[model samples]
Target: FIMENCDELMPDYLNFIKGVVDSEDLPLNISRETLQQSKILKVIRKNLIKKCMELFSEIAEDKDNFKKFYEQFGKNIKLGIHEDSTNRKKLAEFLRYHTSTSGDETSSLSGLRLPHEGEPDRPFYYITGESREAVANSAFVERVKKRGFEVVYMVDPIDEYCVQQLKEFDGKKLVSVTREGLELPESEEEKKKFEEDKVKFEKLCKVMKDILDKKVQKVSVSNRLVSSPCCIVTSEYGWSANMERIMKAQAFRDSSTMGYMASKKNLEINPDHSIMKALRERVENDQDDKTARDLVVLLFETALLTSGFSLEEPGSHANRIYRMIKLGLDIDEADAVEESTSEPVAVPKVEGAEEDASRMEEVD
Candidate 1:
């Protein structure tokens, strides 16, 4: 009976419990209440969890079968990581994920390869997104990949929460690619170039910070962006854009608290981009250029949207876009008439509709 109802006997995190246990030693008078409160039952449950871990370990030894098992019940294991504090490390061993090294294949966290180098091993990198393609093509992953690091693609929504619970696995800290503190190994020449760009773009960065003061924590050149013009990153201890989206979508969550928690983000511009170079020149040459400042604000807001952060002033963004559209089409804003706010005239009642209504009322 316990085997058949193992889900009931086990905790919610262990709901995937299967198989049978036949023991003549259990008391025949073991009522449901007794099973609930008995020390013997506690021993049985502890033994059962141990056996389950052993069985999973055996299954994981065979890649094909483990893949099947993970596909069928991986989310439950992630839930166990979040709920089972006693076996969190063991649960992490069973966690399988899509990693960059595996191509299309998935590998367990323990089985994945650590970076081989003369230097110390870097933190385990991972990216969370709505889809595998979304994470794969992300600007955040570019620098990590360029540095020959493996990044786990976290497609499932539960994956983020799972990593949060299982913070560090096997002495390696898990770091999100979208968050701050990711330092790539740079050559001396590259370092010199970065320093030059920082000094050269210092005023431009300050101008950007001023323009986007309320929306972003700061504006600076990014080490992560290789191809993309700009991207947004969160503070080391703050919630990520993905996390912010998840929290904001919670129906019962307090908006005011979410606002406070999700407010600040950093705008990271690719200083190598041509537009960035031109903007730097423009800012240096004419710091008071309204057009250049508007462009900076527009780029910042666009990056905010692309980086999965919500826009606080979408209407302002739209107006800027409209202005750009006019500029592109060679339409002068000076020639455009302002939209009228005069009260619209109500159409005169159709000639005999009132009389017809009166005749109908008289007939009734």
Candidate 2:
């Protein structure tokens, strides 16, 4: 009954699990470290991982128990998905997320699409944020949710890294809703309608693009906008706002590289939105309309916040908000702040004569 400590056979993620094995295929007196070199032990390790995956599947059958297990040990699963290459697919099955439809409840990656037979084969659409509540209310999911598709809300700190590694599951590509090119499988009629809208809104989008030339790579009529007027989205290869924050927080990240990557963002405008229609009218009336340009700047800044990107020019953002407040209140723009003066105070008739020494010093 010699004790064996073969912890090295297991991944650090599974260190919480304890197990013992007795085999007569190898000598009993062999040290555990030396036995690790044995091909038999390597085979045993492979089998152990397989068994562990099977055990997880069984545990998942009982949803309540698995929820408890996941809440307690879920970080380990995420770490495993990120660090374990050979077993990523198996570990991905254990991934869970809050969703647009699941109201505080969580669903697995496979459950992130419409549950109908005749549904179009959609990719696994998801949004990452600082937390579940933040993503639940994001502008990115508006059209997807309106189209009856569920979106995975990836809120954990490590969820992005884990999903980046997983990439896909069950043959469906995991795509971020915040990515610029979201090609929904539209019917022919829908495509024609979108084409018409694109033509109608082309000039307006161009105006917005020119207004935000330095801040955004492009501005176009959006397929993803249902209720929101606009949103900022990253390019296919660019860092998302969440990923940017993570990398920026790293002590060793290159600022120039990050700046270049972060610059690749686009704005998507809702053709049907009232503000958009009014702005288009304003633009048509005058291409250099100061009010229209100001409104575009405000819209872009607001979209930055709603789309999870921090404002690079917060001072300008604040000033723009103040201007909006003034407009809403119909205050005169010519009203400037009064200047403070350091003119000498005229002590009126010396009520107590306390300033006599200061007045004498000034006279001197």
Candidate 3:
């Protein structure tokens, strides 16, 4: 029937689609042409999808078989999360990844057994990076893990994008705990301090924001960062680092609409970080100093690179490093680098080696 109704049927999409088409109006399906327009075809397609999803869900419920299914069809599940809004919640339930709580191994959704009452069930949070090791050891996840939060190590390129589309799962919000807009509960004292700091650094923050206007949507002091001086975070609605990486790796680099949808990121500096503390002191004491200005630029550029964004001016960072080194060494910034010259040097050459002798003579 499919072969005969090739003109009406979508053949490329029919492969592996196994189902029966029953039409009440057809005389047991009279002819291929007659069956092509049968209203039963629509019902079959819907039923087939429902059956497939049910089968998938059943398989997903089986821990042993779901592992095998995930190994083979995980990408399809991730793609569904990206493309199918209506079914994203269902697809997310099937997705799995390694988490700190999983204890040095990977686990599935069915296996995410939370701790009992009186024990904190810090739902597994995660950040995406190029490697699991990197994500696991990142500064962003360090504090989260310290607080006993189980962070899923999402190294896969699609993991971040897929999770973003799925905002919640099993009554828990899928959160990028590294995002600047994160609202971790803070004490009244900490909140008051944060407000005071914001007021104190208002001018410097404005200046930093102005300088980074093109690359960052905004600049603000963050409570998320602990050890790291600064980090960058995307807007709640923007593409994440992993999404940007996946989009940029596509075959047709500039073709995808996702490339255009990617927006500028926000730079979040830790006010308590030593680097920022020093910067704040310097800005308050001598805001117009060239050295302080250079440090600000360096900090912003470093934040960009650390946050998975490319440096706009690599040379500027290098020069800033040189200047900082000059300051550290108490050397004149103008004379930081010694000029290269072909000046003669006193050196002895081996006898009976005329070419070596000439080379030594040139240096002398």
TM-score of each prediction: 0.86, 0.85, 0.75
lDDT tens per residue, model 2, 1-83: 45456664677888777887767775334554345366776787788889899999999999999999999899999999999
CA-only RMSD, every prediction: 3.5, 4.4, 6.8
Better of 1 and 3 by lDDT: 1
Tens-digit per-residue lDDT, 219-289, candidate 1: 88887888888999998767788888888788899888786677368888888989899999998889889
- Output the TM-score of candidate 1: 0.86
Score candidate 1 by lDDT: 0.82
Name the best candidate (by lDDT). Answer: 2
| lDDT accuracy of residue 337 in candidate 2 | 53
Clashes of each: 0, 0, 0
The segments of candidate 3 whose C-alpha lies over 4 angstroms from its true place after superposition are 2-38, 61-64, 109-124, 255-260, 326-364
RMSD from true fold, candidate 2:
4.4
Q: Residue 264 lDDT in model 2?
A: 76
Candidate 3 clash figure, as a count: 0
Model 1: ten consecutive residues of lowest lDDT: 27-36
